[model samples]
Target: MDMLHFGGLAVLLALCAMASNMIYNHFYEMVEHHYGWQRTVRMRVVHTLGFEAFFMAIALPLTAWWLSISVVEALLLDVTFSIFFMIYAFCFNWVFDIARHRLAARVVADR
Candidate 1:
């Protein structure tokens, strides 16, 4: 495929991944809230593993169809992507929670 075609496909796949991530986090947060669970180290590990595992289910077929690769190839690609996103999701959520806490503190201080 040409560079343009490949680039477009990459962008589409990224968008799909982002959407999936958002949906997964939303529901995960809902469950956490319902259970009153703290974001402890164990919980974070669980969240990271659960999100990545769930995402693999969604990504495998999409990756295979989008790239026209075999299932084995897709699984390999998804595993690589999972490694990246697993770290990424952990850090992103950590930073986001920190920022949210700071913002909330500032708002309370101003009151």
Candidate 2:
């Protein structure tokens, strides 16, 4: 296929990924609140790291083969995104935990 087709398809795929992630944030918050999984700082850290590694493992080979790029290059890019998301996830989950607790406490107090 032509570069134009490849580029367009990549853009479309990225848009879909963005949409999925947006939807997932709601479920992630719900899981944290319902299960208390991310209530502790330590669990949040581990969860973020595991998430990053999981995404890296899934993305590296598929991206390399599909883009016709070197495996090493794809791995490097994947790692970069993984690291960024790891830190982001940790911070976001931490804040979400605090918010979840406060909201829960408020609800209990109201009743």
Candidate 3:
């Protein structure tokens, strides 16, 4: 594919990622609230696994169809991406939670 095609694909993936993040967080937070589950290590691990699994389910088939690759190949690629995203999601969520807490604190302090 050309650079333009790759660029478009990247944009689509990014949009999908954003949408998934929003949807995942909504439901995840609901569960946390219902269960009173804190963001402990166990909850983080569950979050990472659930998020990646949800993403892979949507992405793997799209990737195979888009790239004209076999299911096995797509699964392999998805696994590779999953490994990266696992660490990335863990760190990203950790940092985001910290930043959000700080912002909320500032807002409350200013009130």
Specify the highest-lDDT model's number.
3
Q: What is the lDDT of residue 86 in candidate 3?
A: 93
TM-scores of the models, in the order given: 0.85, 0.65, 0.84
User: What is the alpha-carbon RMSD of candidate 2 to the true structure?
Assistant: 4.6
RMSD of 1: 1.7
Over all chains combined, what TM-score does candidate 3 have?
0.84
The clash tally of candidate 1 reads 0
lDDT of 1: 0.83
Q: How many times do residue backbones clash in model 2?
A: 0
- Give the alpha carbon lDDT tens digit for every residue of 1-111 in model 3: 788876776687778878988899899999999999998778888999999888777777777787788868989867777798899999988888889989999999999
Pairs that collide in candidate 3 are none
Q: Give candidate 2 regions above 4 Å deviation.
A: 1-38
Give the per-residue Cα lDDT of candidate 3 at 59.
75
lDDT of each: 0.83, 0.69, 0.84
Supply every candidate's count of residue pairs whose N, Cα or C atoms clash at under 3 angstroms. 0, 0, 0
Off by over 4 Å in 3: 109-111
Task: After superposing candidate 1 on the true structure, give the runs of residues whose Cα lies further than 4 Å from its correct spot.
Answer: none
Span of ten consecutive residues with least summed lDDT in model 2? 50-59
